[model samples]
Target: MVTGGKSLKKFHDVVAPADAAPIRTSYFIVIFGSAHLLLSQLPNFNSITVVSLAAAVMSLSYSTIAWVASLEHRRHGGSSHVVDYSMTASTSAGRTFNFLSALGDVAFAYAGHNVVLEIQATIPSTPGKPSKKPMWLGVMVAYLVVAVCYLPVAFVGYYVFGNAVDDNILITLEKPRWLIAAANMFVVVHVIGSYQIYAMPVFDMLETFLVKKLRFHPGWPLRLIARSLYVVFTMIVGIAIPFFGGLLGFFGGFAFAPTTYFLPCIMWLIIMKPKKFGFSWCTNWICIIIGVLLSLLAPIGGLRSIIINAKTYKFFS
Candidate 1:
């Protein structure tokens, strides 16, 4: 959310006249968070279908804009800025850490696995016609779309800018001001939906704890207060840190990698009891080993990056 808002501000600054005052980074984050305050009130995942669909479209739109614009920029020799393919980090250790952090980023990009079961629950099912069949098809299609959206952007953005690209590619592309601004806006919209998607599960857990563990009455009042508080807490954290790449690497590894990479495989091994040393068993074990390594190593790089950035960062700035 903070990154999206910051990118939007950067878009404005890019197109604004030289005399225009620079926007404060914190204010836009607050504005972005405010949108979620209302959105969080949505009762459940099923209710946000339209929002989710819009978000998906916006994601594809911005990704297309990013790579396409980057390709055009490269062809036109858009700027005098030198593109260096060399390592950005000065030391070997730094380079190693960056590689680990990149793994976490890959984990994060596929973190949709965290919500897969919940999404499947929403699908209609029966004894003869199982939800898994449809859910599997949907998951496959979603991954295909993800590949389409991600590959071009990663390749073209890196090709055009090398190590000089901003974490958000829209911010790096300065020409075709209107297009970039629109892409940033698309980012904001996509993030709005994404925030809800990720948060819905957390909201469910919170509400469940309140009702079952604490015996709080299950009602709107409880929902309103709990959900709103969650939104506020996340918003404050986002504003305080506002280190986009570092956060992605950190949470992506520490939190998401297990769920995305290994947990399901573990669950399958336990539930399905795949024959030991067989193809299914071997593949799952391989994934588990890789995911565990990612979980252990990626956060070190991410936290180090965060600490480095924090040395020069100001709260809410």
Candidate 2:
């Protein structure tokens, strides 16, 4: 929610500053609520799959343009907007907090590991050999392609805009107005698709829980109302705290460290039953320790970023 809101905010800030000021909580809730309600009308997951594919293509197009543009900018000797790339904390504690928040943003950016299993389930396998080959190959290819797409864009965008780069890279490209507009449209399409993909699982879980608790199997009307309410809830929360990097940082550090890193280490240790103080045990323990430390520290950074940014934003805004 935070990330999406931030992306929207950045787009408005960069592309249409004159009409940006009224981008407050009410506006976000109305627009996002309408979008979610419309998307929720889809009958099933298969529809979402189609949307996700379209999103992938659109995202790829814009990302490629941004990546190439950054390289071109650097080649032309355009000065970078970022002055420092060191790991050390900048002068202020708030800057250090924002830095950690940025780390969370990076974590969110690479967070597809959890979805691989979901994706694997979609691939068909033959009976005889129980061919997991396709699944493995698909996952490998996807990750490889993502890495190829992301690395150059990140490196070049940072090289070109440095610290000045907005959270959404496409916003940095102001030239070639038609292309930029097209890229922004792609961004909107991708965001809509990606939003459905991410939110559907959450919506399903909530609906299931509600059905159980309320002791009623909701018909389509009730289901629609329930999901629409959830969407509104998300929009309200996003409106309240619209700090994009901070939310990414907090969720990444606080949630992903456990799900992505810490839990796996513990699971391996338990399942393998490695000897205490042995190499396997030591490595697992080390990972757990690091994960715990990161989980503790990352949220603090996220919180600070939120605090700093919140001062400038109206609660309704």
Best by TM-score: 1
| Full-model lDDT, candidate 2 | 0.71
- The residue ranges of model 2 lying beyond 4 angstroms of the native Cα positions read 1-29, 74-89, 121-133, 265-287
For model 1, how does the per-residue alpha-carbon lDDT over 51-106 read when each residue is reduced to its tens digit?
99999999999999999999999889884588898998999999998888887778
Q: What would the per-residue lDDT of candidate 2 be over residues 12-92, giving only the tens digit for each residue? A: 555675655556544644564577788976655576888888988987887887888767766766554444555444578
Q: What C-alpha lDDT values do all the predictions have?
A: 0.89, 0.71
Runs of candidate 1 exceeding 4 Å displacement: none
Error of 2 at 137 (Å): 2.9
Cα displacement (angstroms), candidate 2, residue 181, comes to 1.7
Give the Cα-based TM-score of candidate 2 against the true structure.
0.80
RMSD (CA, angstroms), candidate 2: 3.8
Judged by lDDT, which candidate is best? 1
TM-score of each: 0.97, 0.80
